[model samples]
Target: MKNILQVVHFPQGAVEDIRFIKSTNMPYAATGDLFISCNTSDIDANNGGYLIARLDKNFLNGIPTSLSWFNVVWAKGYAKAVHPWDVTNQGEVYYVSGESHGYDWSAMYCLNSQGKRRPVSNWRTHWLKNGTEWKGTPASANPFGQIDSVNYSGIVFKITGRCELRSWNMADFSSVQSDGNGGTRKGKWPADFLFNSPCDPQNPSANSPGYTGYSPEACCPVWGLAVLQLIEGIIMYTWE
Candidate 1:
């Protein structure tokens, strides 16, 4: 008789609701792992940061048996729309868009493939935005895709949403930005790690020059509206 597959139950945060879940493929593991995120109450309020957790991918259903799978607490607060993306050679890195730190304090964050959270103190390469909360499109899925214009597998965080699109070199995880100011870019549009973008990715109409229309690869045909606000996510981040 074939064993019936059972859905494994993972731990949850206090009064948190599951928003999104992704089957993550880790570097060290042969099989993919499970990644889940939850929102507090609703979109209007940012009272709760996105609660995130990761569970091992293993399923078995033969008779009634309790099993505890190894779970990793990925992020705590300000981790709405948790996404794990790879820039071809960039290795695997996760992007955490700040949804609500304290009243919708929107910002973007990055984490390496080793499941290691980069220190926030190094805001230069880790955090983006001029301490300005455009709250444009809160990145979900850590929701974004690769930039089509770039020759190498580059990233286009929010093709349409213009607070600022965050990209980095896979070789060194170096930050790249869309020169909203029209400054001459290097071979790869190399700019400051964390600075204001001339393109303004935090805004909805922020298409930038090299791109056209919303990112079909990122958000599957986003309607011309506040799409990011509709999605609920966990606020996983380091507390100050």
Candidate 2:
């Protein structure tokens, strides 16, 4: 594997995780590029933020052509999802959970190419137990269930140690269900949803770079069965 990009922050910068965004509808970054979720030198002023590493075919020495940085106004750390939404007046949305920074809440945030940030509350989240509305999971109550961690593509999957694979409909942030025929149809949250083991649900996966244990697969439900089968095969072989 070749190192395609490298980010260096002087004095104090901790690179947490990295994601690649495909072509999007955003004006500033219309092409595909790389993004990073990391802690800058100043946490209070540059805490929960991400770096846009514009990839260039000609920029030499494995470096990004340019970098644009933005931080979530109130996020301390541990942010995920930098997906581009066609709506939102030309902006991208991301989710930040307090789980990493020692807070018990998760939320979706939006950012424009101009570095403007805002907390969004457009989710129809009665799917949560207490039926909390957006601006995120209710502070301290987390009606949806404890989110050990979350992964996002077009939809967000909340993975927990309880052997759960809860999904949130991103199309409208409403409730959704598998049609029992491998397709998704409208359904209420908690109800109409299927429950199954996403991993050794007993072994909650950690995303740390140095972590070297059983990592649960973070895949869309469309291929969930295949991933589960592969993981089970690994587990069974290891046990044998």
Candidate 3:
């Protein structure tokens, strides 16, 4: 990893989780790069946000270049996605649920690269950009881009947990088959998520370098996964 990629921040905050997102459009559809989808932690002026990390090479080359940044999302609530849509630009993320953030609880926000959030009339109705702006779920809701000729649809499974996979449609943010399939149900998935990216570190007091930020949790610096991508699909780790 290059020095630039070593330790980076999300504006005036720290990073919570990191995932490499790929592209989903035409020419770059078949080719995907390793981009960082970082969840931000409150620190000083920075509260919550999601920033994309960039590099000269799609993947990482230990001793070559550094890392840069791309589009970002800002919100005081936990603005995190279930999957990395860095370049894909299509997917949905679950937000600051008390179940996940311990104390904070807010509405689930779904947005696009332009930073425009999916407008929902409560939780049962979503407004689209075109057509019926107050009817169905938009394509940007699906983290996997599209599924079976459909955009806001796919089945996701936990990496390591009690398997509970289901066909997800962004329409109402549920898997309960709406059209006799099953209708959205109580689907709560869990897994040991590993984040490998640079972030702000807290001192013994669990604050930023200058005690100028809010710690997401009592735990100061969040350190878990840190691996180097040697090949397109091969990953090498440096567990710190």
Candidate 4:
């Protein structure tokens, strides 16, 4: 008889959810290793982290057994409060954080099987109101203030590797305006503008050159009715 029972228990001090490694070509996946993401009993203890372990296939009498070869991939404060993440067939873990902690806050990054930050030199294409263009590192881009979800798919060409990262989040940003004189006034835009066209962070004008009718209502609501208010859209970022 084949084992069909699944275990729903998390390792001690770990909570949230778990994802099984589905890498068909990786050694770890063949060994039945699983990926687990959790927050410790004390949120302040380890910040946020995940584990990789293997479940006993024996399932003695249908009772799930303890995990083996458990490896906790701690992210210190970098991946604080893990949100949504996915793993590749090559054993690479890609995740988006939930908290803010400097540059790496609310950003996406990867970790090798051994729990080390992998250098991502993939080509990133940005879709903006101005036009699609190549930009800097996508790891710390944090285009959206707080990322809510992330999905990754990897492809290997000979020795070179590439992947596509798709994510969505509630978009929010700050707005600045001149005080009429030589001074400037600053305010924040509501977090409901998800697909609004890009605007100059420092000096914003809704009717600017690249205005694609997708920009915020005249930079500030006081100027006109908010265009994309309370409207959320899926903005995917692909890294090849």
Candidate 5:
């Protein structure tokens, strides 16, 4: 039989080459049950771009398959590019870009069996900030830009059906100023008391030493998941 295959093009560009492919030996035991991640770039632009494709065995035989593409646009006067990471059987993929706009960060997403993309909450909106000086050796100076200087602050938003979009402020954080009206900041604070710090033990002057500014509680949902798991474990152990 003649080989018949389908091809699709992304608005940004087309898939250039297949970089790597791996099959799982444990979770699922099937030949075509494989994960493929590749690179796609703008042919005309010639800077750097990336896309990902997860193919089953049938796809290798020329069947049409859905692919996910991510493109990075460089800011004015900035030369940069984005790169894609390897794919995992758990339907998760990650991408990083830095050459664009003189800064860079990584994004993680979960792919459904149908190839639909879903954002991973914990890894979402995570900027590649410089590791704390106490953590380890000082990281090499980021060529694109510093994470804090490039606005690493993020906001967590809930979407329908437990989905969410975590977005980070892409503007330069170094220059961000508090809204003159402190009472209206978007945190768990009363409108009447915006200038004071609830967590401040010393009650330092506004913007003064010992005055840790308004810090909203971490919106991490992992704690809730852990509690639920603990309860389940206790019940199971008690039955034993």
Candidate 6:
């Protein structure tokens, strides 16, 4: 014989509610239940962070028979808690975080069904620095060699762990050049040709000539708004 289960929906907040169903071959009654997770936001006033909720099976009309709650810390960037494929059998849960320690650093933690948490590993650091580029995005050029007028280079990072792993290069389309104007008009650009045109203080013929938009001494901030955007996208994709 076959069994059917029905699910009901209710409006709450940002997160949605979940329901479960089960069937058996023996002369036994199936059960229905719900699980929920709730918590405070870490990124915004109304969103993002960890949550804890409960699961009740074969709930009475007004009373719950079985209840259990679990906590999860939703991390920023490409980091989140994950369960093993056979989660029903695996009594442990794991969580991971993105490269927040450094250019390519990540962390992991484990929790048993009993809710005892422990560090799986220390913060794992991976240097994605390759010459002047970071994750394939042209960073600072070699001070010894004249920065390429038309070409650039950077480094990328590939991170992996038990719960999650990802490969991230510098923001796509980011470039570094000797002269911002595509290296046009010789000598009009930087004498060292080591900085992006917009950042080349020595560039005399700039896209906006006479305007000093370049900062030769300023090193690009490793963590910028662009980096945050990339990290957000990664986190969403990984968790979703």
lDDT: which candidate is best? 4
In model 1, where is the ten-residue run with the lowest total lDDT? Answer: 222-231
Segments of candidate 5 deviating more than 4 angstroms: 1-14, 24-29, 43-48, 56-84, 97-101, 104-106, 124-240
Clashes of 5: 2
* Backbone N/Cα/C clashes per model: 27, 0, 11, 0, 2, 11
- Candidate 3 wrongly placed segments (more than 4 Å): 1-19, 25-29, 32-35, 49-103, 120-240
C-alpha lDDT of all candidate models, in order:
0.33, 0.32, 0.32, 0.36, 0.31, 0.30
- Which of 4 and 5 is the better model by TM-score? 4
Question: RMSD, each candidate, Å?
Answer: 13.9, 14.0, 16.3, 15.5, 18.4, 16.5
How far residue 83's Cα lies from its native spot in candidate 3, in Å, is 7.2
Ranking by TM-score: 4, 1, 2, 5, 6, 3
Alpha carbon deviation, residue 85, candidate 6 (Å): 8.9
Point out the higher-scoring one by TM-score: 2 or 5: 2
Error of 3 at 3 (Å): 16
Q: State residue 5's C-alpha deviation in candidate 1, in Å.
A: 3.3
lDDT tens readout by residue for model 1, 58-155: 33213223322211222223343442222112222334443322332343433434444433331322222223221222221112221221111112
TM-score, cand. 6 vs. native: 0.30
Candidate 1 runs further than 4 Å off: 1-4, 10-15, 26-30, 41-47, 60-93, 100-104, 113-115, 119-240
Clashing pairs in 4: none
Best-to-worst ranking by lDDT = 4, 1, 2, 3, 5, 6
Question: In terms of TM-score, which candidate is strongest?
Answer: 4
TM-scores, each model vs. reference: 0.34, 0.33, 0.30, 0.36, 0.32, 0.30
**What residue runs in model 4 are displaced by over 4 Å at the alpha carbon?**
1-12, 16-33, 39-41, 44-82, 100-104, 123-210, 215-240
Superposed Cα deviation of residue 13, candidate 1 (Å): 7.1
